[model samples]
Target: MLKPFLSSSFVSGTRLIQRPLYYTKRTMSTHSHLDDDCIFCKIIRGEIPSFKLVETDKCYSFVDIEPLSEGHSLIIPKYHAEFMHQLPDDYLTDILPIAKQIAKAAKFEQYNVLQNNGRLANQAVPHVHFHVIDKPNTSTGLGLTWKPLKTDMDSIKTRYEEIKRNL
Candidate 1:
């Protein structure tokens, strides 16, 4: 029993009805992951038309409308989660295998499998989706500069111990 969020956004030909800020977990069934307001959920449910590439019981994939390269694509789990950490273990199984299949079919010798968890990470959509961006050449696909900061080993060791304790 979920309710729709108040606002809507239009993308391409899809009308994305948004969900509330908070979500609760529930048992899995057909449409159990259907976030009525989520655009990816809507695509999964066929409320929006997509240039579909593949669909399995647990996942669906399609070409990215705004692709970084010629064959840039996305694979999303049928079960909706705003971030990967929130996604159930069962749903995690199919994602990478399917992405691999897509990369092979596209003949992408080099590529980037990108998933962003939040707005700060540039995740425009709320649902968890994995991007298979083709890096056929340096100029075509996802281009980025990885800026790494110098860190204190003592602080890093302390943080690692703290996290290990939680694990």
Candidate 2:
């Protein structure tokens, strides 16, 4: 049973209608499962076509279908892991060398590495992936729009010093 919420039609004195919460719950629950039909999974299985750059027993690197830059690629574990923190250390270690190789191969002056964890972070696919984007010249493929916030320098310095002491 789901609670009925007033829709635009209902607010205008239309018929009382309700939508089931079960549908939303089912959709949410499905997100937790890595889709077997996912393009990345198919790439891992060699069922779908991809321009593979590097591959190991645990990791594979391939050019991104929708690239942020000229030579943007995705590094993913062969075994599906939804988030970065969920990845094993061995799997994590395996991808970095490949990422470095791809960056060098692209002749990039600089590169940006990015990983998004959850929906709020803009992770469209549930599968864990790291993006290595190449920056050829003075331009970095990554752009950030930030408004500088005024903070007390002494407070910032004190916080840094405290963290450094712990280190």
Candidate 3:
């Protein structure tokens, strides 16, 4: 009876131990492909109509079809990167300056350059892209909401002072 009990416990412990899952296979399909089915790919291929703003050797900027404002545009790398983290450093560097140029061309008094990583972060498209939106005024543009938190000013000041000391 004791032997059976001990054996059961050992089996249970061994079974309870779990190995973490690692994504080893680099499936290229998980990234964007230049297919007719893909909207961004169509934009890249010039198959679908887009209001062209700027283009570089490895990137393209076009006005957003669904504009958050009058001058909303998207910046996409010619090479497919599904997520922002997956993008090569060179691709990142090349795209940002072009995005700034688009924002300037739109003549927005203020602009918001935004990107989302995953579905939970509001990434509608798997293909990596940046949204350069015109925010002309506080009113008539995109709005953001945040929950207000109540905190003691003295405590906040103390925390900032401590962080500054370490810096």
Candidate 4:
């Protein structure tokens, strides 16, 4: 369910823009994540178009417009959540199953699951989404180049202890 809205705003890279959003003429939604300005909300409402692959009461699956691989896809909640921590517990649990099914349907042997949070975390869109990339489907899957640094056992223990303390 979503509230009536004329349009939605979204961040494309560092720039923000407003675009049309379509609402299905439902009663006011109580979902906290249903932001009127979020692009994902517009997508859920069928405003901005998407090559949707699956639709559920609480979730939606679609192909990535900017695919890292041929079978790359995205799974999201119907509601908008800026980050995983902002989403409801059930949404977090529901999205993964949808992603798994998408992978199975594509007959992917290997893939990568990715989620980004804030800007520094490379979250281009201000909505919670999971990227499912079929590694075997294309050579560009993820294309992530990581710099691995060597660390000693004591450093590992210190890092672990730091995270534990913060938690």
Q: Using lDDT as the measure, which candidate wins?
A: 1
- C-alpha lDDT of all candidate models, in order: 0.79, 0.69, 0.69, 0.75
Worst-scoring 10-residue span by lDDT in model 4: 19-28
Report how far residue 118 has shifted in candidate 4, in Å.
2.0
Candidate 1 vs candidate 2, TM-score winner: 1
lDDT of 1 at 40: 96
Candidate 3 segments whose C-alpha is farther than 4 A from its true place: 1-36, 147-167
Please write out the lDDT profile of model 3 over residues 65-159, one tens digit for every residue: 88888988898876676788887775675566666666665677788889989998888988899988888878755677777878899989999
Clash pairs, model 3 backbone: none
Worst 10 residues of 3 by lDDT: 1-10
Looking at model 2, which ten-residue stretch has the lowest summed lDDT? 19-28
Error of 1 at 94 (Å): 0.5
Instruction: Write one digit per residue (lDDT tens) for candidate 4, span 1-167.
Output: 43212334557899986643323333325454577788888887778899877665566778998887887999887677788888877666456666776787788789998999999999998998998998874466876778888889999999999999999
Candidate 2 segments exceeding 4 Å error: 1-35, 137-140, 146-167
Please provide, for model 2 over 60-145, each residue's C-alpha lDDT reduced to its tens digit, 9 standing for 90 to 100. 67898888788899988766778887876756755666667677778877888888999998898888898898866555476656
Candidates 1 and 3 compared by TM-score, better number: 1
Give the C-alpha lDDT of model 3: 0.69
- Best TM-score goes to which candidate? 1
Candidate 2 lands at a TM-score of 0.64
How many pairs of residues collide in model 4?
Answer: 0
Clashes of each: 1, 0, 0, 0
